[model samples]
Target: MAALAHRLEDDDHLSDADFIKISNLIGQQVGIKLPPSKRLMVEGRLRRRLRALDLASFSDYGDYLFRLDGLETEITYLINAVTTNKTDFFREPEHFELMQKKLVAELIAQRRDRLPLLKVWSAASSTGAEAYTAAMVLADMVAQRRDFRFAVLGTDISTDVLDIGRRAIYPAEQVVPMPPGMQSRHLMQARRPGARPEVRIVPELRRLVRFDQLNLMDESYPYDRDVDIILLRNVLIYFEKADQAKVISRLVGHLRPGGYLLLGHSESMIGTSITMRQVAPAVFQKT
Candidate 1:
């Protein structure tokens, strides 16, 4: 039995057919394209799932995944395993800089007495860094101006990371890049000698943001009111161009006319069906 276990572990190779099958499943379900070049990465990530289920090989795992009973819950595990949740606070600083210097100023100047609220959406808010960062900026902007109010909605498909964001606690390294004043004002540190330090977002800042599980592939978003700013950064590159167009169109529909859309520095809307005109690098304004 020990020898059999060793052999099964050794036979964890993912065949080309298995890779294609898994890729198709991911694309059909989540709209993420796993091209041939990512075969190795797919294998490495799915290996953990195999071990968790006590499956012997990728082929066996594939069979089980497509089987009627396994189809329901395992797909959630598959997505959780395959979804990449890379994010950092204040990633791509220029977007936030643009918000602080230009976008917020314009919104504030245009605001009327009755409608003094600013609505921001962190569309792909992985682990809540981006949402909290936006909250920090908006909080500071409204600090002296009592009439100005703002709220941030952070959404992602990953339930695990959303839980972490809800906890509002993070490792020290994640908090290191934040400026001193922002850190002092918005975070409380938990530290002990000879132990790793952690940071928690203050309750005031936490109250300004909310997190939810949202899939961009859905035909429509869950928002009730049109948002003023949408941060859909770093997530478009995962989908095929056609899927990108569909997702972007749905996302843009949620934005209020004259609202702003921000994408990752590496992403763009040139080929997509999104009609918002580019006002700055990776920034678009809905006309």
Candidate 2:
């Protein structure tokens, strides 16, 4: 068994047939396009699964994945393995700046007759960084405006990333991009004798944010229909144009009229056909 395990690890490359099968399923299910250029990356990510399943190679993993009962149970692990979760606190500083300087204030002013509770959805909220970042900004607003209330909902397709988001603990370096003074205010350090330094978002901020597993390819999302702001940033680049339109249309359905949708800077060109107008670079207001 030991020798077999060693030999299996040696045969690490994904066969062409297996690559096609896996890539097709990923596109169909998650809407992430896995071009041939991504073959090496896909193989690298799947090796961990190969080790976990004690499979000999990508071909063997593929065989198991396509078997009668393999797909239904293993699909979650597959998605988690391939879906990218590259995120940082305050990754795009300008978006949060807009939220803090103008968007939140404007939304609050528009709804002053009622107690305004802002609902911010980090639509592709990988590991909760974006959602928590938004929460930190809004929490600061609440510090001054006692009447303001907010909740953040973070959704992602990868369960592994969602679990990390729920835990709210990250390596100390990941918090460096956060605005000055916000770190000390919103994060709690976890000190141990010889462990790598880590920080957990403070309970006050974590209480205002939550994470859930949600695939964007779903026909409809089970979420509030009147979300005040939706941050669908840095995610649409993964989908084809058709899929991109479908996703934007679906997300727009959830946004209240005059609500805001913020996309990544690179994704600005893709939302022109939707029922929203660009009010700022990568920022759209629902019509």
Candidate 3:
């Protein structure tokens, strides 16, 4: 252990060859592109894994990662370490506005007869913010229409983020982006003495949303085909165009005809091959 610690102290940086291997493996497993520009960022993130595993260097970590037995157990930790999970309550306010003003009513009217329950999928939900935001919006709608009912599914490649989502606890400041009154209605504060300032989503709202581990690069997802709305936002920028299109096409298969697909503002140009018409900026509907 002393020698291993000395070796780790001597080799602190990720080697170029090891970085390339890691970048390629990440791309293959999760459809994320990690170019040379991100080498430092990758090294910074993976350092946590090295510390966790007590590995001597990036090369040592790489050896364990590529081995079949180690790969099976370490893949989740690797993805969790490197994946970017920037999220906040109501990150894009306009998307929620559109949901409340137009989409929900239309979806409910369209499926009222056969399927009364509206299903929403947050395809790249990071820490449950987007999914919980959607739930808060839909839950508000239920007050106006007694027949309205909904379910939200939040999926991400990082199990770490999903676990955070499932817990529904966040720092108190993270709720600032949420509209007035919504916070009071949906969040419970942790006010005990010496407790850090934090808030948890109310039980009622948490009940309406569920988080799951999912990789968009997989050939198929285990979800229902009649989803009413799918939010694949802010994540496609990490992929190559081909992978982006493939992911969009696969997600479209899960939506019902007339269901909506919401993308990040920058991702509007891709997914042209799919039979979906643009309904709003970064929003599309199946034809």
Among these predicted structures, which one has the highest lDDT? 2
Model 2 agreement with the true structure over 166-245: per-residue lDDT tens digits: 99998888998986789989988776724678989999889889898899999999999989999999999999999999
What would the per-residue lDDT of candidate 1 be over residues 180-217, giving only the tens digit for each residue?
99999999877662367788999999998999998888
Candidate 2 weakest lDDT stretch, 10 residues: 188-197
In candidate 1, which residue ranges exceed 4 Å CA deviation? 1-11, 191-194, 269-273
Structure candidate 1, residue pairs in collision? none
lDDT score for residue 30 of model 1: 79
Ranking by lDDT: 2, 3, 1
Off by over 4 Å in 3: 1-11, 67-69, 193-195, 271-273
- Candidate 3 TM-score over all chains jointly: 0.93
After superposition, the stretches of candidate 2 with alpha carbons farther than 4 Å from their true spots are 1-11
Candidate 2, RMSD to the unseen true structure: 2.2
Error of 1 at 210 (Å): 0.9
Q: List, residue by residue over 1-287, the lDDT tens digit for candidate 3.
A: 99997676556887777788789989999999999999888888888788899987777887787743587888789899899998888887888899989998888888747548899999999999999999999988887777778999999999899999999999887898887788988999776824558889999999989998999999999999999999999999999988988899999999999899999887777645557888888889997
